[model samples]
Every structure is written in structure tokens, then in C-alpha cells.
Target chain A: MIEILDTAPLSSVQDLGRAPYLRYGVSYSGVMDRLALRAGNAMLGNAEGLACIEIQAFPCRIRFRAARDFALTGADCAATLDGVPLPPWWAKPAREGAELTIGAPRRGSRAYLAVAGGIDVPSVLGSRSTQFRGSFGGHEGRWLKAGDVLPVGAAADAAVQAPGFGAEPPQTAFPADWAPPDLQPSTTAVRVLPAGEYGLFMEESQQRFWDTAWKITGQSNRAGFRLAGQPLEFAQRIEMRSHGIVPGVVQVPPSGEPIIQLSDAHTAGGYPKIGTVIEADLWRLAQAPLGSRLRFIPVTYRDALDALRQGDAWVAALRRLAEQYRSLCNSGRTP
Target chain B: MTAEEIAQIATWLRAAGLDTLELTSPQTRLRLKLGAVAPVKELAVQPAAAVPSSLDARATGLFLPIHPWCETPLVQPGQRMEAGEVAAFLRIGPLLQPVTAPSDGIVGRCLATPGKLVGFGTKLFEFSPEGKAP
Candidate 1:
């Protein structure tokens, strides 16, 4: 068990996300950066889709009720356990009564904290992901707050008796050498595919959209990212009935400002979609810090598929390495 | 015992992957411990007093006194630190791993050159117990 001493707003439990409910008007609310969630769980030898705490704002503090192993991934939040500093994207064992504090991130926006057995929240609608809009999933259907206690699931036998017991040293670090090249934060160019209404925009507007760097406005949230740039004008003013939509659809409203749908976006919309961000590049946008500039790069359908394949290959390699390391740790032979 | 005997024992302890070793005889008793990787040839006969110990690098990375941008080092030569207190940091890219003191002691010397890449098991600092030599 873990007790939340303090937390930022919107911090909640999330897994891979709920699916097959878009027809029922429910958005797939999971982690903002799915790769981070998977990486954290992989470090702990937990299932890739296991639920973990998604922390957004910083200075979040939690106290362990029992000895457990945990891993922090995604953003560098300057995490410290019982006053001892921890490296980002690393996993370590925490002793009972140890206080872990996460400070403001140095890079990226959100971080995921994954325990050995995952957070024990009752699954709702096929996922433990929190749908903040509907308030129906995750811990009490809301964000974690002070005094909230989260139960941990049963850990693997090897995880319970690993070497170092509950001790954490800086040497016991996992190298993320297998992360995909595209997953690195050095690039801000996101790949997009032309949607049905791509040709409806004026020639100048289309040119500006490709050439200009768009800044993510402060009004963005889990629902969608509101981009700040030149208002895009349409070649013709056209109206259409409400239609089904999914995350990654770049919808241009009457204000001419484009809004890219995200994990918790509405299931249906009526605005014109100029383009759709490729599924493989959504994680990049998810990790993009607030106010960061982003450029849209058009890619062919085959290119998007190739990017996804690369991501899967990286995850597979990571899984193999993590399993090998876990077994070595269990046998007291980890270097 | 001679310095050659002590050096041989230190080499043996390191080769065996053991941290400490102690042997007692009717005439003289000896204890040998391994710390940082320095010139073992220097481990010669000396006055029987508290010897300086060192904390070695746990991982290979760029050594930082505190953080990459922080001007202040985490510990000074004469500064005293409790067991488990962070004495330095090893930065690998953006990640910073804490280098902790092995025991309660007063820092004697910093062997590691700051802002340089250090290898695993490289001695970073030397310290003596509080009651020992400063």
C-alpha cells in the first residue's frame, strides 16, 4: 500500500486504456505517453499494460506502507526516496515507511510510476484507465489526493526475494539503451496524414500549416491540444453533420484554430479535420512540454506503418532485456 | 608484517571479489580492506593509525560534485557526513545518480577530478572516521 501525502491536480491511475467503447460515446482514456507506461512496467517485470500512477504536476509525495520495488519513467521529475536521490528512468526497491517525493520535471510533461505488481484498482470497462470526463474508472473515478491509499497487487515470487532486499544503490541502474530512435526527445517534428478535408483549405493556409511551427497553447488538456498559429482559412465555408472521430484527428473549428484530439477527446465531432497525426507520433505530442513548438511532417501510410513496426521492435527488445536482468537479480548475479 | 604482504593480501581480496579480510597470528594481527582502485604498490608499511577509506564509483558516468549546473560540491575535504549521506553525483546524460558515503566519516580527500568521466569502481573520495585523523 501507498499513502498519497500530496499531489498535483489530474494525477490518477492509468493503464493502456479502454477500447471498443467509442461507438458508445466514451473516449479511450489511458496514459498520455503510452511508451513511458510500458517502459516503467518493463523495468519492474510487470505486465506492459499494468496500471501505474500518472503524475503531471510536481512536488508529489507518497509514503510506502510496505516494502516494494518501483520504477519511474518518462519525465525527469527529480525523484528522491527517503532523501536519497534517484536517477530518471530507473527502478529501485523502497523500504516500508520510505517517503518518495517527485519534484518539477526537468524535461517532458508527465511521468509514470510503476510498481512490481501494478496498482490494484478494479478494472472498469475492460481497462483500469481513468476517464476524467466521465469519472467512471481508476481509483474512485478521480485524481489521487492527500490521504488516499492505493493497494498494490501481488508481486511475483522472484520480485519479493530479489537481491539487495529493500536496499537501493545508484549502481543498480537499468540502461535504456533499447529505446527506439524516434522516441528520443530531440525532435519536435510530428508526422501527419492528410484527412478527407485536406484539400478544402486555401492554398496559402495549407502552405502555412506545413511551413510554420505551431506552438501548443496553454488551453490544451487530455481532451485535445489547442495549437497557436495563424488562423487557417478554408477555400469554401462548408458545414457537415456530426460524425464519428478518434484521437489524432486535427479538427479546425469556426475560429480557424486547429485542435488535435487526444486520449480523452470526444468520440464524435462536427468540425473539419485538416489532417490526422499518425498513431505512431501521438506519444511524441504527449511528451511535448507545454508551450513547446511543433512542426507537422506529412508521411505516407506505409511510412506510418514502418514507424509503428520500429516501436514494436524496440518494445520487444526491451522486454527481453528486462526479463534477463530480472532473472539475474533474482539469482543474485546482477552486475 | 611487511608492506609486500599487505599489498599481496589486497590483491587477493580484490581478485576474490571480497570487500574485507582479517587474519590473526600469535605475533601480529592484520586486517585488509578494499576501497577505490588506486596504486596498490603504495600500500606499504606505515604507522599503526586510522587509514583513509574511499568511496568508489558505482557506475560509469561523468562525475559531478553536486549537479551539472550547481557550482558547489556536495562535500569538502574536511566536511563530515553521516552514513548514507550523498557525497557526490554521477551524471549519465540527464540522469543523476547519488554517490553515498559508506559510513560516518570526515572526508579526507577527493581523488576524482570533477566534470570528468569515471569508470565503475574508480575511487572518488577518501574519508576517515570522525575520531580519526582529519
Candidate 2:
């Protein structure tokens, strides 16, 4: 177990985000930085949905009661293990009594820390995700605290650790079909699906949405993302009916600005949903550092489904590659 | 279209995974959404759009459009304040305290019940202007 000596606001337990529970009044609680979580877990050779630490605005200080191996990813928080600088997106081992300190983010908003066996929190409603609004997840559904002695768990197969930072991240057209270009964090474009309430707005407002860049205001959280952009409006004929919504659903309240729902959004809402973002690009939305400028390019539903399917296939390929790597490591074929 | 046809369309748009739907009938216009908020997911969506939504008041507090959270209400068709003023306020005990209007607006609808939770961002009053809704 680990101890959280001190922590500030906006930190919580995040897995692959709780799901199929929104209908029960529970928000989809999970890591704000989804890709980072996956990368960390992949380093640990754990299951895909393993729980990980989600760091927000400020970094956290921790003293590992029983340090083993861990990895950091997402948000590029300049991390230092026991005062020695550690690389991001790579795994390393630490002995007991070592202090691991992660500083403020150098790039993204949230950073993910994943260990081998995952955080040992009592799962609620079948998830270890901390639903902050409801206050229940890891460490009593709050941030970890000092003197919190974590229990010991089995180390990952150890042999499965990637040879170096140059290994591939498993199945994808990203490897063979294209130029076999490496999958690095390269582009910054965000995509959206022109689904739902897009038609209600006047043509001018729709044009404005795609024609300009929107700045993300600091007034954002798991609940919703308040954006700063052109105050678009309609001919004054919208009714507020409470309804079910999902993450990435852009809602236009009376303020004329749009509030994009995120992982910790409310299950029901009263605003008009302009559109939903594609799942693949939601990672980019999640990874956006503060004050980052972003734009929306709406795609058709078929395109949205294609993106979803592509994401699913990619994750499946990663899982299979992880299993193969484990087998290879165990068989002494490569170590 | 008739109200029956409009309501039926609401059912279909919802089936199509649509969150916002508008139905303009010869007698009435309806805007509805299926809200998925928590702690109080009760029909935030107008259960019946053809009929007027009730602004049931829990207490005798003066009606204010301010949600206590700083977001101003967007004036739209068939729109009514059920609750919440999302107005940004001074750093108070609450995150964004809902600012209430000093002078009460017209109490177009209210059902008195005191000592309730006084839900955050609930529309406690309905203001009526002398001029008709545009």
C-alpha cells in the first residue's frame, strides 16, 4: 500500500470509467486521461481495465510503503522517483521505503499512475472508480491520504516488461498498412459526430462552430467543460426537458456558450445537446492541457461508429499483444 | 401536426438516441429532452410537452431566475425555469452560490411545501411578462 502525505483539490480514483450505470444515477467515473491510463496499465502487464491513480491540476506526494514497479503516463507531469528523475510512458522498479514524487504537469492536464496489481479498493456497484459527486471509490471514494499503508500484491510476471521504449503497442493498421509510422503523440486535431440537436441551431451558428477555435476555460471539471467561444444562439425556441446524456455531449445552456460533458457528468441534464464527440478523440479532449485551443469537426453517425469500431479493434489488438508478450517472456524466448 | 402526432414524434426521436427534440403543432409547440442528471433524475424532461409544465414551489421564497450557480437562463421557446440559476457568485461556502433576484418576479405558478431540501438550482418562481412570449 502507499500513503498520500498531502493532496489538493480535484483528485480521485479512475479506472476505464464506470459504465452501464448512468441509468442508475451514477456518473461514468474514470480517468480523465484515458490513453495515459491504458499506457500505464500496459506497462504493468495488467488487465486492460485495471484501476490507476488520476492526478489533476496539482501533483501529489507519496511514500511507497512497499514500492515495486510502476509507470507514469499522460499529462507529462515531470515525475521523479526517490528524487531521481523517471521517464514518462516507461516502467521502472522501486524498492520499499522509496519516495516517488510527481510534479506539476509539463504537458497534459491529468497524469495516470498504474502499479502491477492495481489499487485495492472495495469495488462499489461493480467498479472501483470513485464517483466524486457521490463520494465513493478508492480510499473511501476520495483521494489517497498520508499514512495509508497499502497491502502487498504479486508483482507482474516481471519478464513482460518491454525491452525498451521502442516497442510497438500491439494490433492496428497503424503499424503495417500506413507507412508503418510509429504511434507517438503527434497530432492535435479533435473530431466530433454531428449527431442529435445539430439541426436546431441556425445555420450561422453552425458555421461559427466549425469556423473558429474555442478556448477551454479553467472552469472545467469532471462534471462539465465550460468553453469560451463565440456566444452562438438560436431564434429563441428551446425548451428545457431533463434528459439522459453521455460524456462528450456538448450542451448549450442559456449562456449561449457550450458546456461539454465529461467523465464525471450528471446522468440527467436540462440543456440542449448540440452533438457528441467520437470516443477515439475523447482521449484528445481528455488529454488537452489547460487553456488549450481546440476545434470541432462533425462527422456522420456511420463515421462515428467506424471510429468506435476502430478504437475497439485497436484495444483488442493491444490486449492480444500483451498476452503474447507475456507468453514470450514466460517461455524465455525473450526477456 | 396534432399534439398526438407531436408526442409520437417525441417517442421516435428519443428512440433514435436524440437528446433534444422539437415539435410544433397547430395548437402548441413542444421542446423536450431526456435528462440524465443524478441525485434528482426525476422527469427534468417535460413529461408532457403539449401541456404546460408545473412550476411547483416547495416554499414561499421569492422567485428568482438566478440559479445560485452563475449561468444565465437562455430564453428559448417553451422554456420555463423549473429550478437552478447556475450564476457565478462570490466565493461562498458552496462552489458557485446561486444568486437570487432582489425583487421577486411574477409568481405565475407555485405549490407551497416548506422545509424541503430546497434543491440546488431549482426554479422556485415563474415570471410572467405583460407581453406574450415571442
Candidate 3:
């Protein structure tokens, strides 16, 4: 078992996220950087979709209630185990009464820490994610603070066997192959699909859509990204009704800032959507921070769906690889 | 739409091949008797009610303040206009005048504000019809 000892900005349990709940006004409350989530989970041979600890920003601190194996990846936050350096990726053993400390990011923006059995938390709406807005999942739908102890789903010793490794420490979290994506990637020229109110803009207005650079403002979060840049224009004044919003939906507010909704964004919106970021690049949106420049590149609908299909195949394959690794280690007999 | 039904609309729309739909406050019930048969085109309810006031600048220019500092804007939604009602001072040029709204309405809800540096044909402002002031 494990729990929070000290925390920084935010840390919560997340998985692939609660999808297909948008129409009900439910946002997808999942990990911010899923690739990192999968990588860390894979490292520990855990089941797919198990809740992992998502550390956003830093100074995250935690302690174990029992001994277990876990993997950490994503943001470049420096981590230490009781004043000694620890790795951010490989599976490491944690004993009862151990304190794991994480510091501010040096490169990446978000990070994931996966344990073998994953975090033990009540599942809400088919997920263990902590949707703060709804107060549904996670250690009570809130950020962890100092002195918080999280319960872990420690596997029974009979059912668990740690993978054997040579008695040697790894090079470090700075391995070129395992580094997290850019800590704060620029958003210059974001690609988008014309959406609601897309035609409302005059031809030139549409042209201006991609002509200028927009800076991501501080008013950004998992729900959506707010941008500050050249005010976008339309042809005439007409107010249509509010409509549904999806991941990648870019809503232009009265402030002229274009807000691109993310995986955790609300299902519906009143703002006009000038464009949408294609699904393929939606993951990249999670890595950007304030002041990132952005522009939109358009693509055909067929291409968009095809891209989604491709991403689905890739994630599905990744899931198989994880299970296969677990089977290999657990079963003495192999095909 | 009960909070539960508001959740299923996405699947219903995708299965039906429609891209847009709007609903009013009462629709929150999503009673099949009143919802399924409701006109698909009538989905738009109080779209602007959700947004706040904003200024979608269409062009870029310098903003020169004419009047002295007055805390809040004086113009009301239905208030009559006299071609620049609150005149203080003025200037427009090489400056990137963040085109602000002349009248109050949903902020940033507009795709474009009246005059910034919009190309030949860009949307300018989207506002509610001017009604008689109370």
C-alpha cells in the first residue's frame, strides 16, 4: 500500500480515461500524457487501463505502506528515494516506510508512476480517474498535499514475483532513448479541422485563421487550452446556439483567444469553433505550456478518421505487448 | 436531459450521422416523449447564455483613449447609440488595436471583432438584436 506524503501542484490517479461519456456532460478525466502512462505501466507489466499516479508540476512526495515494484516516466522531475537518486523509468523496489521524493521539472511537463498492481482506488463510471470538477474518482477528487497516505493494491506475494535484474544501478533518467517529450513544446502553427462557425468567418477571416501566431495564455488546464493572439474575425454578426465540443475542438471566445479543448474538456460549449486539432496531434497538445505559439493546418475528414484508426491500432498493440510481458514472467511454461 | 442522458447524446448523434445539435434548458430532462421527436433543428437553446462578454477584434490598429478613466462601460444592451456615444479622445494606427466590442454581449463568443486588420471578408461581430431599453 502507498499514500501521499508531500505534494506540489497536483497528483491524481488516471488511466486511459473515461471516454464515451461526453453527451452526459462528463469530460474525459484521464492522464494528461498517455504515452508516458503506457510506457511506465509497460515497464512494470501491469494490466492495461489500471490507475497510475499522474504527477502534474512538481514537488510531489509519497511513501509506501508496503513493499512493491513501480515504474516512473514522463516529466523530467528529479526523483530521489530517501536522499539517494532513483530512476524515473525502470521498475524499482520500494520497501515499507520508504519516502519517494519528486522535484520540479527540468524538461518534461507531466510524468507517470506505475506500480505492478496499480493504485487501489474506487472506480467511478468505469474509471479510477480523479475528475476534480465532478469530484468522482481519485483520492477523493482533489490534489494530494503533505501528510496524505494513498492506499495501494499490493499484490499477494504468492501471485507476484519481481523480475530479476543484475545488481547494478541504471545510468540515470537522462537516457537518450527514454527521455520524456519536450518539457514545454512550442505550439506554433497548430493544425485544425474547420468546425462549428467555421463558415461563419469570411473567406479572408478563414485565411487569417492560419496567418497569425497565437500564444497560449496562463488560463489553461486539462479541460482546455486558452490562447492569446491575433483576434480572429468573421464576416457578419449572428449568434447561433451552443453545441457539442470534443477533444481538439478550438472555440473562439469573445476575447479573440482560441481555446482548444483537450481529453478532459467539457462535452458542450457556447463558443464558436473555428477549427479542431486533428486527433493524431491531440497528444502533443498536452505538452504545451504558457507562451507556446500556435497555427492551424487543415486536413480532410477521411484523413482525420484514418488517423484515429491508426492511433487505435497502435495503442491496442501496445496493450498486448504489456500482457505478453507479464505472462512471460509469471508463467513457467511458455509456448 | 438528466445528467445521465446529457451523456448519451454524443452516441445518438454519431449513429445518426449529424454533426451539430442544440438543446434548451428544459431539454435537460431528455424525456424520449419530448426529446426524441423534438425537431433536430431546434436544438439550439440559450447558446449565448453560457458565454460572458468579450471583444473579437477583426483588425489590428493602435488604440488611442479619448475620454478620461471611467471604471465601467456606460452602454447598455438596448441603450440607443449616437455614433460614438462616450467620446473622450481617439487614434488608430500602426498599433495593434485589440478590437474591443462597442456594445455589451457574450464576450469572446464572437468569431471576430469589427475592425482590426481583417482581410477582405472576415466575420466582425455576433450580438443579440438591439431591443428597447427598459
Candidate 4:
């Protein structure tokens, strides 16, 4: 068991998120960084998609009610266990009463904390993810508050060692090649594929979509990131039907400013989509700080599929390494 | 360093067959070289009588005193550390193997260079027991 000692808004229990319910108009709200949560669970030998705590606000403190193995992944939050410094993307065993303090991240925006058995919040709608909009899942369907005691599921086995270990961060494992051939150096770039209405935009707007450095504005949230830059105008206005939209769709409202729908995006929208950020690179977009400029690099569908396969490969390799480490540690050998 | 402390270090250097003794802290850096008598100014005011021992690396890899994400060093001079606490990490390709303290002690000087490749059993730091000033 773990108790929240101090917390800020937007910190909640989240898994990989619910699925097949978008037709009912439910937003698929979940953890912003899926790979980070998956890697954390792999380290603790937990099954894939187990719920973990997603911390967006800084300076949160948690007290371990019992000794348990846990891992911290994603943003380097400069976490400390009872004043002992913990490296980023590290796993360690916390003694009973150990206090874990998470500070402001120096790099990424979100951090994932996965315990041995995962956070035991009730699974709602076939998922443990918190749908804040629906108010129906995860720790009373709201952000965690001070003095909240969260229950942990029973661990699968006691094979994990106390000395602890770490896994390679995905950024380092698979370096992002952000060299946009036609554009100047941008803050961070994610590959994008042309969407249904890409050809309908004006020639200049289409060129500018790939050329301009779009700045994320203050209005950005989990639902979507509102970008401010050169307004992307269509060749001619036409009435369009509302279509199903998922996370990563870069929809251009009539105002010409584009909004990249994210985890909490509405199930359907009528806005024209010029492009969609590939699923493999959503984590990059999620970690982009507000006010930072982003450039989208065009990629083919084949490239996007290859990128997805590579991402899955990395996660599988890390899980295998973790299993090897656990067995070696249990046998009194250090890997 | 006091005269008595200098003499004690000199005796240890001779007994251990070492040529030099150097120590560093947040506020001071001191070096004692054999066959060269340099005027000793105020350096680290540590417990002179305490004998310092070496903390060796348990694996072969690149050494990092501070984490890649944070600017601060993990273990610094004058900081007390518990036994089994991580003092540094050895980065072997993508894996990070921890270098932990063998016993409770106060840190003295980091003997290994940050980002330099080191082999197993390499002396990484100089430390003494909790009450000892090394």
C-alpha cells in the first residue's frame, strides 16, 4: 500500500486506456506516455497495461505503507527515496515507511511510477485508466489528493531483488532522427503522415504545414495541443461530415490554427485534418513543453508501420532483459 | 592540513608505497606530492587521524559521478552515506550497473574521472567510517 502525502492537480492512476468504447462517445483518457508506463511494468514483472501513477504536477510526495519494489520512468524527475538520490529510469525497493519525493522534471513533462503489483484501483469499463471527463474510472475518477491511500494488487512473485536495477530509456535506445531535410533546426520534431483532407489545402498552406515551426500555445491540454503559427487555409471551404478521430489527428478548425488531438480527444470531429502524427511518436509530442515550437516531418505509411514495429521490439527486448536480471539476482548473482 | 596530519599522511603514503595523496571537497582541493615541498595553505579541515579506504568499482564500464539528467553529483565530500547506498554507476553500453558503498561512511574524494572508462576493482572514491574525517 502507498499513501499520498502531498500532491498537485492532474496526478492520477492510469493504464494503457480503455478501448472499443469510442463509438459510445467516451474519450480514451489514459497515461500520456504509454511506453514509459509499459517499461515500468516490465521492470516489476507486472503484466502489460497494468495501472501506474501518472504524475504531471511537480513536488509530489508519497509514503510507502509497506516495502515494495517500484520503478520510476519517463521524465527525469530527480526523485529521491528517503533522501537517497535515484537515477532516472531506475527501479529500487522501498523499505516500509520510505518516503519518495518527486521534484520538477528537468526534461520531459510526465513521469510514471509503477509498483510491483500495479496500483489496485478498480478496473472500469475493461480498463484501469482514469477517464476524467466521464468521471468513471481510477481512484474515485479524479486526480489523487493528499492523504489518499491507494491499494496495490498482490505481486505475481517474489523474484525481484532489493538492490534494484534500471532499464535503458527509449529515447536513448532508439534515438530520434529529427533532421528535417527542408526545414531549419526546430525544437523537437515528430514524423507525420498526410490525412484525409491533406490534398484539399492550398498549395502554399500545404508547403507551410511542413515548413513552419508551429508553437504550442497556453491553451494546450490533454484533449489537444493548440498550435499557433502561419494559418493553414484550404483552397475552398466545403461542408464536411463528422468522422471518427483518434489521438494524433492534426485537425485544422475554421480559424486555420491546427489542434493535435490527444488522449482526451473527443470521439469524433468535423474539423479538416491535414495530417496525423504517427502513433509511434505520440510520446514525443506528449513530452513537448508548452510554448515550445514543433516541426512535423512528412513520412510515408510504410515508414510509420516500420516505426511501430521498432517500438514494439524495443519494449520486448527490455522485458526480456528484466526477466534475465531477476533470475540472476535471485541466484545471488549480479547482472 | 596541520603538521600532525601531514606527518600522518606522509607515514601512510610511505607504508602504502604511494607517491601522492590528493583530496577534494566543495570548498577546497589539496595535493601532496613526493619530493616536492609546496607550501600548504588552508585546504579541507578533516579528521587527520582517520585512515581513508578506497571504494572500488564492481564492474567495468564508463563511470558517471552524476546522472545524465541532473547536474549535481551523487556523492560529494563531507556527505555521510549509508552502507549499500549507491555512490556511482557504471554505464556498460545501455545498462547502468550501480557502484554501492560497502559500509556506512563519510565521503572524501572521488578517485575516478567522470565519463572515463574504468575496469572492475578500480578505486572510485576515498572514504572513512562515519566518525572518521577522510
lDDT of 1 at B6: 60
Give the runs in model 2 whose Cα sits over 4 Å from its true position: A150-188, A319-335, B1-134
Candidate No. with top DockQ? 4
Mark the regions of model 1 whose C-alpha exceeds 4 Å error after superposition: A160-187, B1-134
**Native-vs-model 1 lDDT?**
0.74
Instruction: Score each candidate by Cα lDDT.
Output: 0.74, 0.58, 0.57, 0.81
Candidate 4 docking class: incorrect
Q: Clashes in model 4: which pairs?
A: none
lDDT of 2 by residue, B10-110 (tens): 44345345676543333444565667422423233434433222233221122333222123432222343332321112111111112222222222433
Better by DockQ, candidate 3 or 1: 1
Which prediction has more favorable lDDT, 1 or 4? 4
lDDT of 3 by residue, A255-304 (tens): 66788888678777788888888865565566555567666667788877
Q: Which DockQ values do the candidates obtain, in the order shown?
A: 0.05, 0.01, 0.01, 0.15
Question: Which has the higher DockQ value, candidate number 2 or candidate number 4?
Answer: 4
**Regions of candidate 4 where Cα sits further than 4 Å from its true position:** A158-163, A181-186, A333-335, B1-65, B71-81, B92-94, B105-134
Candidate order by decreasing lDDT: 4, 1, 2, 3
* Among all candidates shown, the one with the greatest lDDT: 4
Ten contiguous residues with the weakest lDDT in model 4 chain B: B43-52
iRMSD for each candidate structure, in the order shown: 10.5, 24.7, 30.1, 9.5
Candidate with the larger DockQ of 1 and 2? 1
Who wins the TM-score comparison? 4
TM-score of chain B of each: 0.58, 0.22, 0.21, 0.59
lDDT of 1 by residue, A1-335 (tens): 98899997768999988768888988889998887787677656788889999998888999999999888877767888898776566677889998999989876688788888999899999899888888878898999999999999987644622212111111122222223244324436788899989899999998888777788889998889999888999999989888988888999998988999998998899999999988777877887777887778888999888877866655555554455445534554222
